[model samples]
Target: MKLLIIAPEQIPVPPRAGGSVENVIHQITSRLPEGHRVTIVSLRRGYLPRKSVSGPVTNLRVPGGSKKRYLANALRRVKGLAFDLIQIDNRPGFAAAVRNAFPHTPIAVFMHSMTFASPPMTTRRKANADFRHADLIVGNSLSLQRSLMSRFPAHRSKIAYVHLGVDTAQFRPSGKRRRGGYRFLFAGRMIPRKGVPTLLRAFKIARKSVPSIRLSVAGGTGKAAYRAFLRRTARRLNVPVRFKGNLPRKRMPAFYRSGDCFVCPSQEHEAFGLVNVEAMASGLPVIASRNGGIPEIVKDGRNGFLVTRYGKPAAFAARMAELARSPELHRRLSEQARSDAERYFGWQLTAAKLMELYAERLKTASAGRRTK
Candidate 1:
């Protein structure tokens, strides 16, 4: 089957910068069943050709502009291309427009987040209309699926959830064990939602018990003020912290291996924390807040502990200290974490599930047409 995927305008297909949605799209397209043709439409830098082939996927680049304009221009450009199915990644407006432009094709709107949670009334209305018309809607996690259902109960029949997958080959465990002092790692955008300040306080408290405990914070800095606040808090509390600037996706495995434990203290409801899977794949015990889809992946006390009492530095600190002190516990969790990742979260599994869904949709569409 020929597939055309419309990605968000911010990121390209084979994501150079870190984009979870783009990365997933790339993985699904690259791993699709043999003989299936795939084309991706996304934004491009200045003056590049409008269309080109990148590796096995055909990329159509729309000039950077307003979301509405990008969608309009892209629809006009792809009017001539034929496809059996159209997959839209995360843009409600784009999904609505594409449904109108190609009414007969099977369209699936893949939801990556709770995008309509806090938007204005007008935007919410538009999103509702878009979602209502889509033939299928898939969320990355059950948490996100529930949120969507709560907002649009009428669409629940069409909504389903699929867990995002990680590249196990790139994130497999190193045979080396944790040496020297205990190390903790936090990777993601340094934003308020990420709970960096809370992480700092927790790390400082953990250091009181384990003086040799150190933290390595890595990811893009979202806000300069928040970055400054984190630094000041670390210094004021005398926590030994190292700020590793945003590392590329290729270098993430080394970053995960360099630490003994992984912590994600996100205060916001994450759709799915891809980093959690990557760290698990790297064989590091993870400690994350029990919010959103995090619980679906972390499996509290099995692979790692999930801190339910969020925003409490003491609770987070206790978990960190426990992992640092118990090498036996750490070893057990590490082995289980790697096992879980390999068994459940590989890109191949994700692609195979998607292929099955696509084939089912195509078959159903064919049957409906024959009945008519």
Candidate 2:
């Protein structure tokens, strides 16, 4: 099967920068079986070639001054190209444009979150129309799938889910740090909804019980004022936190290994926490909010603890303090985290399942044609 994957216009495919959607695209395309050819259509960024080929995959980059321009450029280049299936990443408009170009081909709109499917991004009428046109709708988590199904009950049968994954081999466990303090790591944008302030407040409280406990924050961009506010909040609370500004994808494995535990204190409904999977792959226990699809990944007292009251600092502090004080619990959770990542959350599994889905869709399409 020859597949064309249209990545979100915001980021490049071989995400030299950092983007979860782009990373997912690159990982899945790279791992697909050699017998099945793949073509990636992505926005040009940095020094990536306009067109290139590697193994069974082809890279096609387009000028992306704007989302509109990106779509125009993408559609123009692939207008006459034949593909078994087209996968549009996180954009309803792209899926619509692709459908206009190739009406008969099977199209799948992959939803990484509810950000694009709801009000403010696209309305119920427009989103419903887009879903109706597509052959399949994919969400990265069951929570996201259910949410979409609820919104567009007419398209419930088309909405399916597959969990995102981490590269376990690359993000292996590191030797335990002998530093006196137990460190917790946070990797993501330091935005309000991300709950960086909440984590800082929680760290401050956790430190009172375990004085040596520490926090290291990695990843931040586009919100300089918010970043400054986070620093001020940490200082005013008398908390000592290390802030590592937006590190590239290659450095993330080491960043994950540096911490004794990973904390994702998101105050919002996270569709799925990919960073938590990366941390678990690195053998660190995860302590995340019990909202959204997080409960699907981190089981309480099994692989890690979940903060039931995520918005409150005390809730997160309790979990952080629990792990900091108990070495046996930490060790057990760490082992289980690594085991779960290897056994369940790997890019290979995600890629295989995606390929199977595409193959099945193509087979069904071929049968329909034969009957016609």
Backbone clashes per model, in order? 0, 0
Query: For candidate 2, lDDT tens digit of each residue in 1-372?
Result: 889999888888888857889999988888887689988989886678889898999999998888889999998988889998999989976777788889989999999988898879989899998887788898989999898899999999878898889899899898655565899999997678888989999999999899999899998769688888888998899998999989989999999888899999988889999999999999999999998889888988999999898989999999999999999999999999999999888898999888888788778778989999
C-alpha lDDT of candidate 1 relative to the true structure: 0.86
| lDDT score of residue 173 within candidate 2 | 94
Question: Once model 1 is optimally superposed onto the true structure by TM-score, how far is the C-alpha of residue 307 displaced, in angstroms?
Answer: 1.0
Residue 315, candidate 2: how far off, in angstroms?
0.9
Q: How high is each candidate's TM-score?
A: 0.94, 0.97
Q: Ten consecutive residues with minimal summed lDDT in candidate 1?
A: 115-124
Assess each prediction's global lDDT (C-alpha) against the native: 0.86, 0.89
lDDT leader: 2
Q: How do the residues 1-372 of candidate 1 rate in per-residue lDDT, one tens digit apiece?
A: 788889887776667768878888988777776777888888876545667775667878876578888788778879977889998898766776898899888898888887643375246666778786688888888899898888888788878888888888889888886687999999998878889889999998888898888899998875788788888988998778999988877788999989999999999898899999999999998999999999999999899999998789999999999999999999999999999999998888888787777788789779989999
**Backbone clashes in model 1, listed as residue pairs:** none
